[model samples]
Target: MNKPIVAIVGRPNVGKSTLFNALAGQMISIVKDTPGVTRDRIYADIDWLNHQFTLIDTGGIEPDSSDIILSQMREQAQIAIDTADVIIFMTDVKQGLIDADAKVADMLRRSRKPVILVVNKVDNYNKMMADVFEFYNLGIGEPIAISAAQRSGLGDMLDKVTEHFASLKLEAEDDDRPRIAIVGKPNVGKSSIINKLTGESRVIVSNIAGTTRDAIDTDVKWNGREYVFIDTAGLRRKSKVKEEIEKYSIIRTVTAVERADVVVIVIDAIEGVTEQDAKIAGIAHENGKGVIIAVNKWDAIEKNDKTVYEYSNKVRQILSFMPYAEIMFISALTGQRLYKLFDMIDFVIENHSMRVETGILNEIMAEAVAMQQPPSDKGKRLKLFYITQVAVKPPTFVIFVNDKELMHFSYTRYIENKIREAFGFKGTPLRFIIRERKEK
Candidate 1:
C-alpha cells in the first residue's frame, strides 16, 4: 500500500531530531546539542495505530540564514515540505514564540498544507502546558505539547497527524508491474543502466509517479508491460562512509531493497564479484526477493567463446547460497543485451509469485518420502502427514509432521528440492515451514 508522507520541520536546535527518533523507535537521526547538526533528510516508515506513513526528518530550515550550508539545508527542507502530505512544524516551549518561529509559520500558512504545531522540550507537563498556549497567537493551529527528550504525549500527537491523512490522497500503488531494485557497490554503473533503460526515446510510463523527493525511481513500459525501476545509492564500505549523510543513504538503500519485488544485483565485469558483491546479493536473497545478477561493463572485457562460461562459473562459486539467481552479462555503456535483462526480470517475477495446488504438493511429498524415508531419530522414524503451500512471493510451504523437532534440516532440503523439480519455481527462494500435526 502507498502510505502518506509526513515531514518534521523546524529551525535549528528545537529537538526535531529528538521527536523524530522518539516516534521512529530508534536512533535514525543523530541528535546533538549543537545547532544545525542534521544536514540531510532522513526517511523512515511509521506505523501508527492502523495507519501507516513515511516519516521524513529534515535539517533545520534557516530561511533567512545567508550561510552556504544553512541555505542548502533550507532547500532540502523545502523539498521535504513540497513532497510531504503533512508537515509537523516543531518549536521549543522554553524559547516561547520568537520572530523566526513567526516567520516560518507565515510561510507554512501560505502553503495551505496541513501543519501540526508541535511544542518540543516540554519536560514538565504542568509548567509547560501553560506556556504552550502562547503558540496559538501564530494563527496556525493548536500547539501540541511534547517532551521529545522524555518521550511523552506522542500518542496524542500521532492521532492528530494521522487525522490529516484521510483528507490527503496518497499515490496509487501499481500492482501490475514488478518493482525492480538495482543495487551494488559504489562505481558499479547502477545509474547508467537505469538511464539507458529509461532513455528519452524509450516508452516511459508517465501515468504513475513517485511521491519521494529523490527522483531515483523511474517507471517505464516495455513489451506492453509496465516496470518500476528503483535506483539505489551505491552502498559504500563502512570505513569509506566518512560523512553523516552517506550513512543515511545506506538506510535508504535498505528501504529500497525491502520494497522491491525483484532485485537486480549489478556487478563490475572487469573486477568480477568481490566479497562486498556477495554481501549485497546475500541481503536480497535473505529477504526472499527474486534475484538476478547482471555483470555490467561486459564490453570492456576481452573475451573469447569460453570466457563467458568461465566468468559465470566464478560468479556461481562466489554466490553459491543464491543458486536460484540467474546471471546475465551486459554493458550499460553500449546497451548490450539490455532487452534480455528486462525479459529476465519479468520471468523471475512470474516465478516469485508461483503457487502450487495442495493436491499436487502432497503428491510430491508422498513420492519424496517413499523414495527416501525421513532420517530416523533414535529409532523413531519421522512422519510427514502432508504438505501444502501457505503463501507466495517466496513460495512458502508448510509440512505437517508427527513432531516438528523430528524434521531435520537435511530432510527439509530434500523435500524442497523435490518440490522445485516438480514445479519450476526458478529465480525465487523456497521456504519450508515445519509444523506438528495434531491428531483428532
Candidate 2:
C-alpha cells in the first residue's frame, strides 16, 4: 500500500530529527548538536492509531546561506515540501521565533498543502504554555507542544497529523492481477523496457497521469491477462546523488518496491551483475516479493551461442542469496525475447500466492525426517510433533517440536528444500517458524 507522506522541516537545531525519531519509534536519522550534520533526507514507515504514513526527515533549512553545503541542504528541504502530503512545520520554544522561522513558515504556507505547526522541546507544559502561543504569530496554525527527548505529548501530535489522511486510502491488492515493479541502477534500461512493453502491441489499461508522489504506475494487459507495472526512479550511488531531485528519487523507488507484488531486478548484461545490482535484488528478497532477474541490453553485448549461458551463470554467482529467483535474457531496445518476460512474471506471481494442503505438507515433512534424521545434541534428539502451512505469498509454515533449541539453521534449510522439491515454489522465498509443543 502507498502510505501518506509527512515531512518535518525547520532550521538547524530545532529538533526536527528528534521529533522524527520520536514519531518513527526508532533512531533512523542521526541526532547531533552540530548544525548541517544531516545533509541527506531520511525516510521511515510510521503507524499510528490504525493509520500508516511515510515520514521524511530533511536537512536543516538556512535560506540566507549561499555556501555550497547549506544551499544543498535548502534544496533537499524543498524536495520534501514538494513531495509530502502533509507538512509538519516545527519550531523551537527555547529559541523563540526568529526571522528564519517566519521565512520557513511562509514557504510552507505558499505550498497550499496541509500544514501542522509543531512546538518542540517543551519539557514542562505549565512553564512553556505561554511560550508556545508566540508561534501563533507565524500564521501557520495552532502549535502543538511536545518534548521529543522526554517523549511526552506525542499522542496529541499524532492525532492532529493523522487527521489529514482520513480521505487517503491505503494501496490494497483488490484485483487478481499482479503488480510488478521494474527496478535497477540508472541507465540500466528500466525505462526502455517499460516503453517497449507498453507500445503498439500491448493495451494500455489506465491513462491516469502520474504525479511526483505517485511513482507512475502504468497498467497493461497482456494476452488476456492484466498486470500493473510501476516504473521506479533510477537509483544512483550515494556520491553521485548531488542534486536535490536525485535524492528524492531513491525514496520513490523505495515506495514502488513496497507496493509491488512482484519485482523484476534489471541488470546490464554488458556490465554483468554489479554490487549495486545485488543490493537491489537484496531489497526485493528481504521484502519477500517474488523476484526475476531481467538481464537487459542483450543486444548491445557481443554474443555467441554460449553467451547467454555464461551470463546466467555469472548472475547466479553474484546473487547467491536469491537462488529462488528466475533469470531471463532480453533486449528492451529491439524487443527480443520480451514476450517471455510476461510469462515469467505471471508464473512467479502464481507461485508467490500459492497455498499447500496440511496433509501434503505433513507427508513431505515426514519423508524428509525419515530420510535424514535431525542432528542431535548430547543424546537429546529432536522430536517433531507435526507441521502445518500457516501463510502464503512467500509461503510460511510452523513446525511444532519438542525442543526449539534443537532446530538448527541447516536443518531448517533442508526442510525448506524438501517442501520446494515436493511442491514447486518457484520464484519465491519460503519461511519456517519453529515453536515448542506443549504437553496436553
Candidate 3:
C-alpha cells in the first residue's frame, strides 16, 4: 500500500528542521561523509503511533536572495499543495504573526488539502498560550503550540496530523497492474520516451488523464501486460532561474516516486552523469523503489567497445548509493535497446515485490553470524534473536535483538549483504526495522 505524505512549510528560522529531526527520531539531513550518501533529506519515512506516512521537508531548497520573503514563502506553500496529503503550516510564536504568514495561510486554505497550523518555540505552553493564540488570526486553523527544541506538545500536534490519514485516498492509486514512473532531469528525452512507446503498435489503455496536482498518467500495454507510466516531463521554464528549476524537478520526482513500484531514471548520455543526476537517483533509492538507469541520446554520443564499460563505471561511481540499480544504454530517437528497457523493468518489478520465508531468512542470519562475529563494544556484543520478513514491496524485515544500541551500521550492512547473496534483491532497496526485546 502507498503511504500518505505530510509536508512542513514555514519561513526560515521557524524550527522546521528541528521539528523534522524530532519526528524522524534522528538528525536526518546532516551531510554524511560517506561518498554515495546524499545530504538532501528532502523526505523521510515516518512511523508514528502505528501510522505510516512519508514526511517531506518542503524547505530543503534554497530561496533566491533576489526574491522577497513573501514570494519564497508562497513558493514553499505551493509545493506543499502540489505534493502533500496533510500540510503542517508552522509559525514561530517568538516571531508572532506577519503579513506573509497570513497570506500563505490563505493559499493553503484554498488548496483544500488538510492544513495543520502549528506555532513553534512554545517551550512554556502555559506562559506562551497567549502568544500562540495570536496565530489564530492567520485564519487557517487552530494553532497547536510546540517547542521542537524541547520536544514537548508534539504528541498533541501529531495526533492532529494523523487524524486526517483515514480520510486520505492513500489506496486510490492502487491497482493490479505494475506502476512505473519515468523520472529524469529536464530535456533528457522523458517526453520522447513516452511518445515512442505510445507511437507504435502498443495500445494506449485510456485517455491521458490530468490529476488535480497536474501530473499526467498514461496506461499502456506491452506484451499482454498493462503498466501505468507517471511522466515528469514537459515542464514550462517559467522560473528561468537555475535553483528554482532544480527545486521543482525534485518536487515532481518525489511525488511521482511515491506512487511507483518501479522507477526509470533517464540520463543524458551527452552530458553523462552529474551531481544533480546523483541527487535525483537518490530519491528513488530513498523511497525503496526498484530503479533502472536509462542513458538516453545514446546515438548522439561517440562509442567504441570500451565506451559502455567506461560509461557504466562512471555512473556506478557517482550513484554508488544505489549499486543494485540496473544500468542500460538506450536511445529514444533510434529506439536502441528500448525493448530491453521494458525487459529490465519487468525483472526489477518482480524482484521488488518478492518475499522470502522466515526459516530461510533466519538460516542466512545464522550462517552470516558464524562467518563473522557480531561487533562488540565494551563487552556488550550485539545479540541477534530473530530475523523475519514482515512485509514486501521492497521486502521489509524486523530484526529482534537484545539491545538496539549494540547494532552497528557496519554490522547491519554485513547482514544485508548476506541476505542479498542468498536471494538476489536486485534493483530494489531493502528496509530493516530494529526492535529491542522488552524483557522483564
Candidate 4:
C-alpha cells in the first residue's frame, strides 16, 4: 500500500509545532538566508501502529494579531487540504475556541476531506476537559484532547489519524512504473524540462482529474512502457510574488518525494550545485529514493576538459550522503541526454529493488567477518549470527547479532560496503535492521 500523507493545520500558537514534534519525535527545520528562506517544521516520516505516512506541518509563518489569524489559518488549511489524505486540525485548549479556529473548521468541512479535531495543552485532563469541549462547536468532528508538552494522549490522536489510512485511494501498489520526481529550486528550467517531456508524441496518458496542481503526476511513455514522472520543477504558481513563491515549494517537494520511487534532482549547470540544491537532494536521500543528479541547461555553461569532473566533485561534496547517486550533464532545453534519462531510471529502479539470496548473504557475512574481526570491548567481541534480506525498494536487511549495542556504526558501514561491492545498489540507499540474538 502507498503511504498516506497526513498534515497538521491550525492557527499560530495552537500547539501545531509542539504536536508535530511530539508525533514525529524528530524536528525537521530549514532557515532561509537574507534572500528570505523558509523556516518551519516542514515534513517528517512518521510510523504509528505499523502504519507509515508522511506528516507535513503547514504552519510556517506566525501571524501576530488576531485579525490576521483567519487568513493565516486559511492558508495553512488550504495547503493541508490540497495535499493530505487526512488532516489533524490542532487547537489550543488554553486559547479556548477562537473565532479563527471555527472559521477554519468551516473551510475544512467544505473540502469534505477527513479531519481530526485535536485540542492540545491539556496537561491535566480532568481540569482541562471543559476547555476541550469548547472546540466541539467547530462542527468538523469530535475534538480529541492532548497535551503535547507532556507527551500524553498522542496515541489516541495517532490512532484516529491512522484510522483514515484504510480509506486512502493511493496510486495502486502494483503499478510498476517508476515514479521519478523532477525537483529543484524555484527556477533552473523545471517548467522547461516538463514542457519538453510533454511535447513528446508518445505520452498518451490522460491528465488526472480533481487533483491539486502538485498532486497530479504527468505520465510519459518511454520505451513502450509508461513512466510516471512527478514533475516538481514544472509547477506554475498562482502567486507570482517572488517572496511567497518558495513558501509552499518545500511542501510540494516533500509530497512529490514521498510518492516517488526515484528523484531526478535537477540543478543549474551555470550556477553549479548550491546549498539549496543540496537541501533538496537531501530530501530524496532521506526518503531512500533512487537519485540522479541532472545538471540542467548544460548548453548554457561554457565547458572545458575538466568542467565535468569539477562539477561532479562539487555536487558530490555538497551531497556527500549519497555517493551512490548517478550524475549526468543534461540539457532539458536541447533534449540532450533526455532519452538516456529513462535508461538510467530503469537501471536505478532495478538496483533500488534488487535483492540477494540468504545463502549468499550469509556467505558474504562470513567472508566479511573473516576479513575483519568484529569490534570488541573489554575482551567481549561482538558476535555476528546471520544476515538476511527482509524487504526491497531500498533493499532492507536484518542482521542478527549476539548483542545489538556491540554493533558499531563503523562496523555497519563496513558491512554495507561489503554488500555494495558484491552487488551495486547504485542510486539507492540501503537500510539495515539490527536484532539481538542469544549465541547458541
Question: Best TM-score goes to which candidate?
Answer: 4
Against the hidden true structure, what lDDT does model 2 obtain? 0.75
Across 1-440, the per-residue lDDT of candidate 4 in tens digits comes to 56798999998887887877787774343322211122344777787768888888887667679786787778778888887899999999887887777889999999989999998889899988987888778998799988888999999989999888887789887787778888887667665676677785322222321112454577888668888887662233344433244557777788888888898998988888877677677778777789898999999988899999988998888777788899998997799987898889999999999989999999999999999999999888999999999998889999999988899988998999999999989888898999999977
Q: Which candidate leads in lDDT?
A: 3
TM-score of each: 0.67, 0.79, 0.82, 0.88
What's model 3's overall lDDT? 0.82
Q: After superposition, how far is residue 294 of candidate 4 from its true place, in Å?
A: 0.8
Candidate 3 lDDT by residue in tens digits, 215-293: 5677878999888888863333245566666666777788888889899999999999877788778778777799999
lDDT by residue (106-215, candidate 2, tens digit) is 77788778889989999999999999999999998899998988988888988998998875555653765678999876667776688788884232223221122224
Candidate 1, 1-440: lDDT as tens digits: 44677878777778887787788775333323212223243555678899987777765233335353344444444554555678898889888887767867777788888999999998888877889999998999899998898988888899999999888754355465678988876567777788788885232222121112242668978888888988774322122223433333334454566668899998999999986677567557655889999999999999899999999999988888777888999998899998798889988998999989999999899999999988877888789998888888888999899888889887998998898898878889888889997754
Model 3 vs. true fold: TM: 0.82
Instruction: Name the 10 consecutive residues with the lowest summed lDDT in model 4.
Output: 203-212
Model 3 steric clash total: 0
Task: List residue ranges in candidate 4 displaced over 4 A.
Answer: 26-41, 65-68, 124-131, 200-213, 233-247
